[model samples]
Target: MAICIPPLDASTESSAERKLHEALRSGLSDDFLVLHSVKWIAKPRGAGPRDGEVDFLICHPKHGLLVVEVKGGGVILDYAMRRFASIDRHGDEHEITNPFEQAMRGKFAILEKLKESPFWQKLGLGRIPLGHAAFFPDVDGVGGLVGPDAPLDIIGGRQDIALISQWVDRAFTYWAGPGGQGALSELGAGGVATVQRILARVSTTRPLVSARLVQEEQTRIELTERQAAILDLLSRQRRVMVAGGAGTGKTLIAREKAARAAEEGLKTLLVCYNRGLADHLREQCEGIEGLDVATFHQLCKRWIDKAKSELGRDLMAEARRDYPGGTEFDHHQPIALAFAIDAFGPNYDAIIVDEAQDFGDEFWLPIEMMLSDHADGLLYVFLDENQNIYGRSAAIPIKGEPMLLDKNCRNTTTIHAAAYRYYRGVRIEAPEITGTKIELLTAPDIDRQARAISALVTRLVAVEGVAPHDIGVLLCDGRARSSFERALAAMTIPKSSRWGHLEGYGQGSITVDSVAKFKGLERAIIILWGLDASDPVVDRETLYVGMSRAKSMLYLCGTVAACGRVLDAGVA
Candidate 1:
């Protein structure tokens, strides 16, 4: 049977009350009493003129029950007044609710219901006391809801509310669980009702992190005139394609742009086609804050799933405005895009597709679709056609449309110069470091190269002070298993995986495989052990990708003749 709870805050309510209600929805306290109170005393949403519903309910097992409510003026903010939330229709204007009195009325309604409810007597619910509270402030342009009795004035702000939450949690500990459930149920019931009534009037503003968190330190890397010009316009363009060769700083430039965006009060998203490049970014962006970095594929999965849950779309459709595009965002709008996202679910605020060169062809469509829908969202991208180790023929996602960051920051000047001479048509600017002599090494047979590589790595890590983790070997035919076997037999290396993928963190490595697999990845030293010169360009590309992986060193021990020919023009 339905229980009747009076509409307690009936006196004065409007749309201004939404923020408070929404904030309390999903996280209705973990305490058993708190949870019960919230669920049982929930105010009938949309039953009146208020624009929103209560945040959440907290039914206690004992003590006066708490009806949790949130409140703020039109806005909530950081110390310098960077608005996190506003209480009104726009960022301006305060709501019109007296939170305190409204809370009392809510308490009364719950009491009324408790007295009449057969469920109350059957369950012994009426003995519970009642209490109510309103909380969470509004920031500029952000909002919150309030009961008619809410405190319209701003207090200590967001920090105060955080403290208040602690107090509330502690005070209600008596009703947290099994031992406390029964007593709390009777005592806190009324308090929960009042809070619900007021809470029902609140709404959730945007999260604070997205709006406020920022970094203070900044640094600079000199840019060429062309680089400066392209980057300048790139700062403003949302969707851009950046393509170039070895020293282009395509990666470096992208990082700077993302950092700059964060500084401009916009979120920064950095992505790469390869795990290696992504790792390199993590290493490079170590100190800079506010950059949300990830691989293109990973982000696509996240946004689509998040959006789907929010919209509740169990079925698929074409271009559902709501569905977020996931993993395969190959450019151009496609019917397939809708189906894909319909399954995964939501879109993100912005997107940055890195390493566009290596992503399989025909993947830009969904990306275009998602980036088109969001506000102030980015569609930033970076890549180098010459660096397409995957051999996919997908047209670069952006034409004149992309912003290029193709400056090589990882290589020395000699390496950069050599890359340019050896690899023509590649659009990378050489690093300014003086050249390091390129050498070729080969054994009487395959055995010789392997031993040299293994020894080189051991020496670098043990004597050179590089972490064993910082050295990697690139071998043909997926020789990681072979290496593991030898290492296990010889007891030279331990059998282990990087980052605990077995525990479900990531797909990590224990050995050598295709250079493509390690694209975007880096180690302090790279040892390219096996080589076949059958396809010079292909081998050159693989060598390029591998060489670029090291921040400090590259140890290549392959067919001397083949190596020399590949490096004949120059060394990358």
Candidate 2:
């Protein structure tokens, strides 16, 4: 048996360790770099512990600072004193992995690999002053990496944890160089370049994702600088959260993220608010291989169904029975149930949530429950608090920071800027496609609105080259069906009706759809007809979501006043 194990609370200590790292980053005269949460699976053939991820690797210039394993986790492990260390590894397999030892071996391997890399000297982030430590920040007064009777420091007035940390800092100071000055600039030039090359190779050969946008008629649809930056940020972070206004491409980013996960050999789930978006996502992700996208409720229902099927009960009956009706519920209840049961049912390696602000408190509880303690799954969230009409989500749920996606990609920057003018507080993210313009039309009634919309759709597809499938129309409630169909019939545009179905729209089914049901998909030319300026909810925002759907052109068909409202809303 080992006399003492490494610190077991590395992750918990991450907060404090992070503070120290940030301090080092700010105070260090030279780079004593800490590589965060780098997974180091045992190479195909190697010595030492074969599989695990490294929390941090301290890179000094000359002498190697150790690769440290941080454990935010507290509580000591005394295996010799106790026999209750049995760990369930699933499927009847039982094993015990001491976190300390695990961390130690990981440190050794990372240091060894860094020492042997080709770019160790050229790119500048060299591996000379390298060392490793397992920090437990929560144990403020704690010292050493052991437990209660095992002789570990506990947080208290008597504990000398700060002194111990200072000692560790001094102990590992040699990693920053002979005198610990950490001037390995020459070394970094080479090491940084080499690490980049190596990572590039690994990514090319065995990537964490394989991604591409599925666009047949969106040649003009270009990703803005902000969109590209968001993608870049997504590439670096293990957990990414995107918060943007409506028509800000949150769902699109979520889809793109799914594609990236698939490219990286990870299974991904694209979760949305309702079946409309869910079904739309399902259809869109059809050609993207290895992507397992679905609605959260749908996926949860599937899980509950699978679990319940084994117990011999009708899953649908049970799920719907809770509502005493069908489909819609208190909204929070289904979400709560999904979050609860599937908390441990991640079922996949990566997850992306869209319309996140619509989710409730207990929603994430299920996700947390489903995650394995040491699992390397990536969690990404996409949401916009401004779009949260229901007051459901909180900023930074699960402690994730929001990455602002202010560039609007769905509309011409001009039209997107318009919504911001109406709701001036909103920040509009610009699109890469610059020439597209917003057109507003004044109509006496539905007849004129339909005529204007039909004319706009025809011009966009025929004159501008936008695909028929990429053009869509959003009609406000009442007489919209007859108005849209009559206009389209006059033009001989073939259409289908989703009139009664729960998710009532399709790719090429028809030109006109309800604003609520057309949540997940997008088109190049979007016409919103019959927008009622009088309705409280159908104001700037209601149309904002509708207008942002068009990639090239937007046509608003409404009363003269409503038309003016739309036109004024477009000019931010």
Candidate 3:
């Protein structure tokens, strides 16, 4: 089987080109390298500048190079007027350049481009055989269609499709005389690979993170508009729960609900469990009047501070003394907020919660109490059970069945496939965008992993144009987080590099956080590090949250055995 650049099924509007491409791909031997639709611009010496496309360029070690110009449909040649036309299936005739002339021009243009490369001269490739041909797949026979330039041997018809190899050999022999050039035979596989490298140089520029974010935002807007009907259907209901898998725009819908309530002149509070998510929600609702955004803990702190005098005691001191250091925030905050709200009365006309799955069973009471009218005020909750990393089985207190959002508007198809392995709920239709594959970087230990991550971040920021703030380093194990931080700090930082934790996010630095803490938040690029084959905490739920946090690019870095375990687990 011949190797075809762009493949035979690649998108093309020309049916004739596709037909000839298929013939060349299927009929040629494995030694042949066929490039279809090669665009070039050249200004040969003693000739006007030529800029056009070559329908097909075939290269072989034994036969040298051949440029083929293919014309589909009915071919009409006007010898007297020196004009050419092709009639389509609709019987509409369109004048076109002579295929023979086009083939010759393309052949020379490519030759000229190749000669400009020093490697071409180093290999003495100029002495190799070169030829051109015109193929008309719709024409039955072109044996009698001879002209000064369009010789019978140089023109191919539909009948030649089956004997394409023979036809190509004949054309090469015609250009090389009775005996082929010995130089052609000497251009072996290595020479062919070098030629391909010269013709199609390895060059690429990744889309800037800012630009990609804009494109993704636009797609979300379109998908979100499609979900507007769901919101409209439940507009009259005062209390509703929206359930969805990750990337299903649950947070987007929650934001919209809060904004709508504010638009209606009702004071609204948009709250979530994660501080990162709360910060994001606040940014999204910045200018809206009558709307307030805060993390559940932040909301608790606010009310607790306001009701301190009525309680007649330092609640923070009491909680610190009664509970363990970190337990005080989880155990005493919500209870204190409830008492504060009861004394101060309800603070808002409507309340909205996002990432509701992260809240404890008792957390709902204080959330509901914030509404001015507990029975009639709007209370909207958005939750994804699969993302419940906190191990909370708390269900929303809403009475009716939750509305389901099954279409994922965020994350590329590749990311979705990897993340959905651990998902066990209603099916989520993958996003339409088929992004690049997830990259897995394996290292021997934490130090090497940190170095690899640093190198990757450098390339992404300095070479690929990705913004530092748009990239995140999410640690899978809590213990590895400090090791990575120490490794990064001890290294000689690049002049352009800046690293920070979630606290310094958006401060023009690459943010780092634990996967559990970074839940409900996303970044354009995520580097999930510190997976251990022996670590029990690196389970399905943890992997799902860490991998899905990447909106575009994902890199999994860990020990070889650990990375192997993830792949063996079928998360790829």
Candidate 4:
């Protein structure tokens, strides 16, 4: 049986085309390759450019090339008017293009396109035989439909379906003419493979990193506009808590709200739990005056330092004296910030907290106290409970019901499918952007995994034309991140490659970091490494956060057993 490019399916609109496709697939030898619905645009030497489509482009090592046009229903040809039509089962006639002309034009156009390839000249395939034919599965006899261009031998009818190979061979012979057998034989198996490669290269294409990013940004803007309605609805509310899953634009909405508040002459502070996210917010909100961005601990430390410098009060020392048991940042910093807020009084008119689920109950008091008027000051908190990897259970101080963001606008549908398996939350509507599937690359150990990753990175950058900075390598096992980094550093990478953390992401280097550090952030392409099923730290939440970071493409690299465990964990 012949191989089909797209594989014959019921989705084909024309019943006649489907019938012909099946007949060719079953009747042709294994050497033949049938490509259906092949469309192309061509510019002949003296004529203007024209668009053409061949219903079936048949290729064989021994038979050369043939373009076949299939007309399922009754075909009507008017030689005087040079017009053609098709009669349906209901006896209704629909005007149609001349199948013979279309097939011939498609054949020439495809031949011209193939000739443009340097490979054709190198292989000396210019003299290879090429032909065109028309097939009418519903018509009883097309032998009388011969003309100057439509020869009787090149026109097929219902009875010819059983002997499609012989009919095609006859068409080839008619086009090749006498003594053209040498030309047909010239396109040996090797030459035919070269032609296939040329055709495939010309036909297959993918968007580059820049174009994909632009498309994704446009989609994000549209989705953000849809989420803006929620802000408009809550414009008058003093305190609001917005809850959503990852990629729901919580951080984006928070930034917009903070900017608007600052524009109103209100001092606004935008804070999140992740330092990388905080740095990103700071960079994005740089020129906006009266708005400050920081992580919760960073804000606490900044306030304590200011109090000690200007007010002659060492709040950090006092907090250390009072709370001496737990970690300084966790226990003492919030206390110090509360003391500093008391000393300086409310300094901001509004405060926006992103990644609110990462903040503990103790952190909200000082946060609320930062508002000039606690009763009427604006406080918006965005949180996704599922991403509380640090396991903080804070009862947010917002009064009214939290608004729910159900749509995910960040990750593509393919990445969403893998990530949402571990998500335990309200249903999140997947994004409309359907992207490439998650690729799994397995090795036996970290050394082999590093080599595979290096090759993949090179291909993505050198061959696939992806920017180095657009790619990221995230370690699923945070503890093994350094080990993976060392292994990768030992490998021979491209000279253009620069390895750094998420802080240096998109700055002309490929960044590598733990999935936890990259929380609340995303990259266009993500390569997740060090996925060990035996590691206790690599749990469902870790997988969810790591896999969700990819916006366009995702490659999961690990040992076979590790990858198998991940797939078995419902991520398949």
* Per-residue C-alpha lDDT of model 4 across residues 1-572, encoded as one tens digit per residue: 98777788777999888888888899988888888887543334444334456788888776688899888788788888988998999999999989899888888888876664445656765467788999999988787778778989899989988998898888888877877666355577776676565443222111212212323333334435457656654455677889888788887788877876664446789998988888777766778878999999999989999998999998888988988785687778999999999998988877999999989888989998898777667788898887888888897997776899999887899899888887887789998999988898899889889999999988888788877778889887788778898888888767777777776555457889988888888778999888864442347778888888888898989887787677557532
Please give the range of 10 consecutive residues that has the lowest summed lDDT in model 3. Answer: 203-212
In angstroms, the error of model 1 at 2 is 74
List per-prediction Cα lDDT, in the order shown: 0.48, 0.53, 0.75, 0.78
Q: Highest TM-score: which candidate?
A: 4
Candidate 3 structure, TM-score to reference:
0.59
Error in Å for residue 38 of model 4: 54
For residues 373-392, write the lDDT of model 1, one tens digit per residue: 34345667777776776676
Better of 3 and 4 by lDDT: 4
TM-score-better candidate, 2 vs 4:
4
- The backbone clash count of each candidate, in order, is 111, 69, 0, 0
Worst 10 residues of 4 by lDDT: 203-212
Per-residue lDDT tens digits for candidate 3, residues 1-572, read 78888776646888888887877788888999988877543334443334457888888887778899998888778878998898899999999998898899888778776665445666764466778998888888687667878888888888988888888888877877765575454556766786676554332212212212323343333535446655654455678888988777777778777876665456789998888777767766788888999999998888888767666756666555655554655668877777777778988877888989889876888888888767667788888887887888775789887889988766899999888876878788998889999888888977888888888887887888776778888888766678889987765545666888776664457877888888777788999887874343337778888888888888889887887676456432
Kindly give the stretch of ten consecutive residues in candidate 2 with the minimal lDDT sum: 203-212
Q: What's model 2's lDDT at 453?
A: 61
Query: How well does candidate 4 match the true structure, expressed as C-alpha RMSD?
Result: 20.7
Q: lDDT: which candidate is best? A: 4
